[model samples]
Target: MTAKRSKVAPRVATGGGALVPLPVGLSEKEAAQEAYRRLDRRVHARLGAAVGGVSVIGLAQAWGDWASHLALSPGKQMELVWKASRKWQRLAGALGRDPDSE
Candidate 1:
């Protein structure tokens, strides 16, 4: 007796009643390169916007602090001045500048 192998039919029927394989045109390398290009542009744009926002906020805070000092008493004003000077010294040190020299 000869053994017969049965053929499997398509799970889903197409318009022509034929099974068509899914199409994937791009190779792995090409797909990865395309994805990286898109991601890089998106990340760079977001980072630029964030940096700009931080800079604007810093400027606004500095201006507001300066304006509020105008209404302070002489003793209180001096205290604010000392505090600001210390903050400046710390900022300079963080930037690799010598706080005591200049």
Candidate 2:
């Protein structure tokens, strides 16, 4: 008879040197948002490079086009930020308490 070997999972290291388990039960929207946030970082870096390589007039035109395309006035953007912050605040509050906590 031959002996069988067991398979092991890869370990992820945390800042405290502990092997923290991966998060579970994220909804589709949450997963998409996480992906978008990562993409946003990369896109922002590329935008910075593009802006630096272009002339001032080109940069200004690009900025104007982006603002118009998004159709977000400064006031509306601020309002959106406020609403997102409040939504996250509520989510954090809900997560902080145990499911059985009263």
Q: Candidate 2: which pairs clash?
A: none
Report per-prediction Cα RMSD to one decimal: 18.9, 20.2
Task: Write the residue-wise lDDT of candidate 2 on 8-102 in tens digits.
Answer: 33233543567633234444455445556655766666777867756657778998998896685787788889999999999999999999868
lDDT of 1 at 17: 60
Where is model 1 more than 4 Å wrong at Cα? Answer: 1-24, 53-102
For each candidate, what is the lDDT?
Answer: 0.62, 0.65
Query: What tens-digit string does per-residue lDDT give for candidate 1 at 1-102?
Result: 543322332132334566443224544454445556655766666866877746655777988997787676688878889999999998887899666877
Candidate 1 lDDT: 0.62
User: Stretches of candidate 2 above 4 Å error?
Assistant: 1-72
**Poorest 10 consecutive residues by lDDT, candidate 1:** 4-13
